[model samples]
Target: MDKDKSIDHQLRATWQAVAKMYNEQAANYGSTMAMAFVLLTIDKENGTPSTALGPLMGMEPTSLSRILKSMEDKGAISREKNPEDGRSVIIKLTAYGLEMRKFSKSHVYQFNNVVREYVTEKELDSFFKVTSTINKLIADKEIYNAISQDK
Candidate 1:
C-alpha cells in the first residue's frame, strides 16, 4: 500500500509536523515541546507524583527523570517526599513553572483554535472517533491477535 494512503503514516507525519511547530514556539522561552508537555501535565494546586508522571505522559522513566532534573535546575519545579508514599516523590511547580504552564496552555489553545477554524465540527468529531477507535484497538491487542489468529 502507498504510504500516503496508510492511516498510521498520516498520523505519524501530522504528529511530527505538530511537534515541530510546538518546539519552535517553545524555543522562544528556552524550552522544548517535551518540557512544555510536562509542565502542562503537572497538577497546578496539588503536586503530581513523580512515579505517575511517566505513565501519565506515556513517557519512559529515564526521560521523565532527566526532564525533572532539568526543571529542578531551572527552578521550574521542586521535588518533595510524598507523604502518602515514602518511596516516591511529588513534583510541584514553582512560580516560574506556573508561568510557563500558562504559556504552554495558550499555545495549545491557539493550536486548537486554528485547527477548529479549518475543520468542521463534524469532521473534528469523526477525527476523534477514529483516533479513539484506533487507540482502543491497540489497547485491546485486537490488531496483533487478529493477525496471529488469521495465520
Candidate 2:
C-alpha cells in the first residue's frame, strides 16, 4: 500500500478509537460538543449570561435554552438573573456539575498523554496549528462574531 493510504488508514483508526472513548463518556452524561462547551465556558467564566453563551457554542437560542433547561433539570447547572442585565439569565455549574467535570478530567488528561506518547511534542504542536487552521475555515464565524458582540 502507498504511504498516503497507510497514513489515512491509521488516522481513521485513531479517530474511531477517540470517538469511541468520547461516546462512552458523552452517552453517560447525555452530552454533546455543545454541552461540553457550555460546561467548559462556565468553568472558565464562573458563569455566563444565556444570550452570550448561545453564540459561543454556535447553538440557536432555542437549542441553547433546551440544553440549559436539561442541565438545570439534571442539577448540573443553575440559572440566575444577571445582576447587571436583569433581562438576561446567567448560567453556572452546580456542585454536582463540578464533580462531573472532575470525572472527565482524568479521562481527558490520559487521552492527551496517550496522544503525546505516540506523537512527539513538535508533532503535537504542528497538529494543533493545523487543527486551528482547519477550524477557522470550517467553524461558524458568524456565531463567533455574535458571541464577541455580546461581550
TM-score of each: 0.98, 0.69
lDDT of 2 by residue, 1-151 (tens): 9766674577678778887877677778766544655676674446888788877777798988887888888888998898998898888888877876665665678788987999999998998896676577557675468778999
- How many clashes in each structure? 0, 0
At residue 138, what lDDT does model 2 achieve?
51
The segments of candidate 1 whose C-alpha lies over 4 angstroms from its true place after superposition are: none
Per-residue error (Å), model 2, residue 66:
2.3
The TM-score, computed over Cα atoms with residue i paired to residue i, of candidate 2 is 0.69
lDDT of 1 by residue, 12-131 (tens): 999999999999999999999999999999999898999899999999999999999998998999999999989999999999999999999999999999999999999999999999
Off by over 4 Å in 2: 1-19, 28-34, 137-151
* Cα deviation of 11, candidate 2, in Å: 8.9
